[model samples]
Target: MATQEEHPLIAEYRRFSPGSETLAERSTAVFPGGDTRSSAHYGPYPLVMDHGSGCHITDVDGHELLDFMNNFTSLIHGHAHPAVVAAVKEQASKGSAYAATSLNQIELAELIVERVPSIEQLRFTSSGTEGTLMAIRCARAATGRQKIMKMEGGYHGSYELAEVSLVPDPNERGSLDAPVSLPIDKSFPESVLRDTVICPYNEPERAEALIDTHAQDVAAVIVEPVLGSMGMLPASHEFLAALRRATERHGIVLIFDEVITLRLGDGGAQSVYGVIPDLTCMGKIIGGGLPVGGVGGKRELMQLFSPSQENPVMHASTFSGNALTMAAGKAAMEAYTGDEVKRINALGERLREGCNHAFQQAGIKGQALGMGSLTNLHIASNGVLHDARDSIAGMIAAGHIPRLLHLCMLRRGVASASRLMFCVSTAMGESEIEQAITALHESLAELGPYVASERPLLVA
Candidate 1:
């Protein structure tokens, strides 16, 4: 099955994406990394977009790819859903922004409150980064505690502390009980590291003990039910429940950063796990495809942001409740009913199963692990995976295969996050899911020789 010994892996990528390379060269003179967004950047370059509709996106090179990436899973209905497009267009025609409250904002908030069990009152933000940031600050203000406990490898946003200890280096990740807060980049301040208490993910007893140990100063325990950036590993029920129990007992706020996992169910992952959080941070589908985010919870915690309060948290964003985003969110939520959510979740399950089968057939050590609508492809030694260490090990073993696999899928008219995370959109069904699976099977086959020649440990 060895194709060509002379051709290198990255050369294959360059061959397939000449347009992206051209665009990257053109972009480098302006943007620092030849791209404005660091998350979207990969080894060679990224596909430049032309337009998208439904689940398909046409690139600048005229390739129509099935968009599994879906703008990092924010496009719940996939690009330009009729209802969302209509709502946004109508709102835009009327007015885009007003530094005051609007009916659309209220309607969108009502829709979110109605579905999410824990969110009684909510505050909108321009981005998920702000949502999580505000949630943490609110927790601190409410509890009067300065420190926050976050799971290792859990990425809440782009901010410093949110990403502290996010990439646990073997050289610096201290111990399992007390993880050293490793900065993702040089910009992270010492103060940000000091305020953070790192907790090992999925280690119930250790995590609970750590949370309890720092209970006095720990303002909040923030976690993602589905670990989005760390290879899409879902937190075990016991771990999340432990955090809830520990935080409750110690007067520490428990926040579910559902920015990604809210799509798991009608009421979010908290509903799925049967554990409630004191505060929930939401993004993605809530805004349809528009840029929006929000933080919400019981009135007690949420009310801290209310103007009626004497000393309210200073949470402000100019476009927080912009008319266009609100209208888009309302329309998106209105069309995304309980039944529709379940349908997409079922489709997600189908996609996962198909991808797993593809890995088996291709003789690769990998698995698709996630819950509900979100899934991530991990090149693991086993079919099962649990924690951050496992995810890191798998990535190390796979080496260039993940990037190569992503490129291979792209060439075959499929699109996924550079990290290989996928979310099912309402625009997708079994056929689209099957196309992705077929693409994966073929991509893995095409990659087999490279895997054997380069990283043979990846073979099952």
Candidate 2:
């Protein structure tokens, strides 16, 4: 809920987007909280987008805003790329899905196998949630173990165990050495918490020690190279290497959840870090703006899903590897070459640098921290953010400033994740990057007085 003091910004937003406000009010009659997806929802209400082209999305009020969020970094080519649209149209005319395998599915899988080092064989699912769930099941079947070790802030999917200790509350998270498995909400079962071991992000020695203690019952150790929900904090090579060494020593399957981080390079973050995992779970950009998920690994492990196996992992989904998604994904991935990856990554650096400078110029205690096409804003004293705890502390200290800033940016003709995560798409260029930076400068200027009065600590 928004506080009374936040009404000014909320009022300004409502005034600017009266059409969206009406739509949101009407939506509450059907959808819960005026929105169906929780991640896309914000405090006041989200802008209802009508259509998108290139990097610009027009809301219902006909406001053409630059789309930096890219549908939470899934739309790598931004909205409706010609090639992707062509492929989807062609496939849709034939048929959306089929009970048997299709050529597009085989082609996309081959492309992925040729690119990613960790995935020798793979299977698709309807969403990233299913991808991670299947990966965990595969590990348990192979190792005959019940426990799964995951990072404190790492988010795999929507499932219970995948979300264990997702938000590291400073109060309930216990100590740095031994973090408690805290749930995001009351829906989580106690059994999920017990089965999950929470490892501190970016802490190498502590993670190794935890793995050593629970090596016996642990089936798999899953991690994201770049922690997505926790402010896009990138994991250190040493920390990932530590996980690899420990998991290899214990004979535990190591899984890398590269759903969001696959945009980092041609072969994903595992290629960037040179620390390979036994199983790699993927989604986001791989789906080419469609709902898709996949998990792949060494032949020995992935073969467990083979029907020929006496007792396979038992994976089945109605829309897994559907024709329309496969066609779209193939076209999108084909266009996303190594050169394109390099270009967008350079743009990401430009965005982060410009945003950081904007914060300094506005005299605000904030900074942009992320790597290669992904950026997240946080309020901090030293601009030094290491983990979820650091990111959440900065958020708590800033009160409602972050939410206000999001609205201010949207009004200034820029759109990002409500939490302030930004990414570069193929449709964006240096001009769009500069536009976002300029919007940040103006938004901060508007909010400067409010921060000084209500949140003095945030006024640097």
Candidate 3:
């Protein structure tokens, strides 16, 4: 199916997913650049997925791949899990949504509150963006402050400020103590830069200084327990502790954007670190593969959103607590017990070891970094990355190898985030983990000669 007219690698890729190219050609007319989602977009064209079951997905080109992307870590139970499908089917038969509230919404909320200690009371939203937005509004309503202090590489949502300095250029980003709020895209307004006070990640002292400096005007300090967009970097316990202490001292609300990290445990990443945030934003895994998001926290703070209040924050969405999403979420969360969390985390540890082994065996400068079931591959000699700046160093060391590696893996029947994010699902067992490990070794082998010929520094 590959056309001989293209580059050998592109031709081989086309051969593997030829139908994808044909579909992509047609898609460009409908969707910009043949893709609606930017994260999933890559060179040539992404494989057009036809269907999925458990931990595997089949493309239109007839290539079956072990799906590690899991719809950007949303499918904790993987595609078409029996429980989720049954829930969706039953809810669909009745009705997808209604003007009135449903019992399913309460059930899902109760489930989340039971697991996460910080979330004494909660509210649902249609997406994580709304969840973070409402959390900030609640903070402002409570403290009567406007500005927010966020970590240098933290990504809370799709908005301009939420992604401020998501990929901070070292040249533009100032000192760690007073990091300049740099916009990732041109869509950002100057107001976003003025309102957001950027703090260096994993630097407790710098974070403390920033919070103290902006304490008077800072309403909330938001951060991700594990920086998802910046290479799965885990925030240090000391750093989080600093934020907690500073926020408490300054009456500034602390928000933990646990959207991607809710999968870390039944209690989420905050439980793992033993440091709780005043507010927690959640999504992905909780939605049961349907679009969903939530913000939950202490009773006093949550009271700001209560309708009983005279001038409460007006938070409304047609699909905020929709029945279908709640039913599916309840099913997924109920099945994803504490024991299952431990099991998947154990499997993640195995996968990490396997990847480290693969890099060593292949004599390549690559390492796997993450917490629990979440993982990201970094091409670097450095063993661990603590912040975006550290990740930039790794990015430079690897050059364009990571993208080539992703394409190579896709051809070898494996799929992950273009940024190389890999997560474990309840649908995957030791066998699937092993298969992925083998894929890593084979992928590196296929890439080794090219790296040796092209970039010698990548060789160990």
Best by TM-score: 2
Candidate 2 C-alpha lDDT tens digits along 1-460: 3456666878889889988988888998899999999999996889999999999999999999999999899999999999999999999999998978999999999999999999999999989999999999999999999999999888998889999888867889999899999999999999999999999999999999999999999999999999999889999999999999999999999999999999998999999899999999999898899999999999999999999999999998999999999999999999999999999999999999999999999999998999999999886554577887887788788778899999999999999999999999999999999999999999999999988888989888
Candidate 2 stretches with Cα past 4 Å from truth are 1-6
Each candidate structure's TM-score, on Cα atoms with residue i matched to residue i, is 0.97, 0.98, 0.98
- The number of the candidate with the highest lDDT is 2
What would the per-residue lDDT of candidate 1 be over residues 44-157, giving only the tens digit for each residue?
678888899999999887889999999998988999999999999999999999998899899889988998999999999999999999999999999999999998889999
- Give per-model CA RMSD: 2.4, 1.4, 1.4
Give one digit per residue, the lDDT tens place, for model 3 in 225-323: 999998888899999999999999999999999999999988999999999999999999989999999999999999999999999999989899889
> lDDT for every model?
0.89, 0.93, 0.91
Supply the global lDDT for candidate 2: 0.93
Clashing pairs in 1: none
Error of 1 at 6 (Å): 9.8
Worst 10 residues of 1 by lDDT: 1-10
Clashes of each: 0, 0, 0
